[model samples]
Target: MGRMDDRSVIVTGAGRGIGRAIAERLAAEGAAVAVTDVDEDTATGTAAEIGGKAVGIHADVTDPGSVRAMVQRAREEFGRIDGLVNNAGWDKIGPFVDSDPADWDRIIRINLYGVLHTSQAVVPVMIAQGGGTVVNIASDAARVGSSGEAVYSAAKGGVISFTKTLAREVARHGINANCVCPGPTDTPLFSSLFEGNDRLRDALVKAIPFRRLARPDDLAATVAFFASPDATYLTGQTVSVSGGLSMV
Candidate 1:
């Protein structure tokens, strides 16, 4: 039997990239997944592709009302929510000094506030049930700042800290919260960052001890581990899946 058999999970921003991979992995492991994304079509498409107890719902994590509705729908679909994966995020690369304040607001809203909205809406459900798991997808940039990603780093850093505190507060209620920090993974977002800069891409590859970027499946595997029974004793921790790029 799969480790996550009979479990139900709600994954935000699961329409594509790393989030999609996480949903696919968990569903493969026998978990019924609620794949929620701001893009309704992508969400439904992903759910259709996974084809197992997965259901796609339109959810905007930045809005508490949307998040609450998403959580409610998941419960209605699966009877109980066993896991929550906060993986929806966005970023624009550029000099911090040149960054627009408006961009900063948008970045913080989606990256930081999004997590808060989902956690607040879902944690109570986990409490009502016996236990559950929370996996927040942060970034290695949060641990060691990345150039041109100041605000994004700040937002992810907040996520890391929020997760730790949330973990402490919820542990007594049988809920485990953890954060996963991914290095420069080979996602569409990463590709967009170095579109015309092969030199920068090659430099990054050389800098990484592994000589390659991380795959979406790589991050997905770690998330699955955290969501499974194997991680029952772990809580309030941050695991970096950066292929040794950052050893802190």
Candidate 2:
């Protein structure tokens, strides 16, 4: 049997990139997943490819109403919620000094507020079910600040702190909360951040001890571990999956 057999999970931002990889990995381990995304078509497409035991639902994590509906759909489809992966995030790579106030709001909304909305929507379900797992996809920038990602780093840092506090509050209820920090992974978002800047891309590659960017699968494995029975006793912890990029 797979590690997550018969479990039902909701993975936000599963339309593509690291989110998609997490969903696919969990499904392979026998978990029925609700692939939620702000983009309806992309979410549905991801669910379709996964075949039976998966469904795509529109969820805008920045909107509480949308998040609530998304959770409701997952419960209705799967009968119970066993795992929640908060993987939706966005960032604008540029010096903070040159950033607009609007940019900060966008980063905070998608990166920090998104996590809050999803967890608020899903945590109660897990508590009522007697137990569940929550995995928040943070960034290595949270642990060690990144040059061009000041606001993004701050938002993710908030997620890390929030996870710890929530974990303590929910431990008695058998719900686990944790954060996974991914380093410079080779994803669309990452590419877009450094697009048309070969020098920056090459510099990032050189910084990593492995000399190669992290594959989506590299991150999926860590998230899977957090959502599995193997991590039942592990909570309030932050694990980094950056291919030796940031070691603390």
Candidate 3:
């Protein structure tokens, strides 16, 4: 049996990237996982690869109703939720001065509001069950500003603050809420952010202390740690998995 054996967890944005890696990690640790994404096909595809222990649910973390439904579906499938990983987020880069309202809104809605939506939905269930763990996937940009990611950085920074508040407020009820901040990672989303420029990607690799970009699994491992019993006393904190890029 694994450290999280028999537990049930939900991982949002599992359709791709770090979210998909987190879902896979949790499942491997023997948790009944809810692999959720706005795209049904991709979510189900990941769940299938995680074996029969996972259930795929279509969810838009920015939507309260969809988030509620996701929580309901998790309980229905696994009987209860013992953990949660808020891995759903989106971003667009440009000078904040000229950034489109639509892009700014989208980033805030998904990266910040989604954390609130998903956390509020699952906290009650976790409370009812005595306690649970929550891992919010934040970004290094949130901790240290990025050149072209002003709004995105703000949203993720909000998440960091939200996590601390939520962690303290719910700690008495047996819930642990924390965040994992990752630096540049070699995921499809990372490539998408660079506009398919191969040289730019190489430049990014040289910027990190490790002389390499992080892997989705690298972030996933930290999320999994925060979600596990090993971190029972850990809460109201942000753990940076940025390959020594940001030390705090």
Off by over 4 Å in 3: none
Q: Please, what are the lDDT tens digits per residue for candidate 2 over residues 48-103?
A: 99887999999999999999999999999999999999999999999989999999
Candidate 1 lDDT (Cα, whole model)? Answer: 0.96
lDDT of 3 by residue, 11-108 (tens): 99998999999999888998899999999999999899889699899999999999999899899998999999999988887788989998989999
Q: Cα lDDT for residue 46, model 1? A: 99
Tens-digit lDDT track of model 1 for 173-221:
9999999999999999899989999999999989999999999999999
Count the clashes in each prediction: 0, 0, 0
- Cα distance off (Å), candidate 2, residue 93: 0.6
lDDT of 3 at 20: 93
Compute the lDDT for candidate 3.
Answer: 0.92
- Angstrom error at residue 173, model 3: 0.6
Q: Candidate 2 — which residues are off by over 4 angstroms? A: none
Let me know the TM-score candidate 1 reaches against the reference structure.
0.99
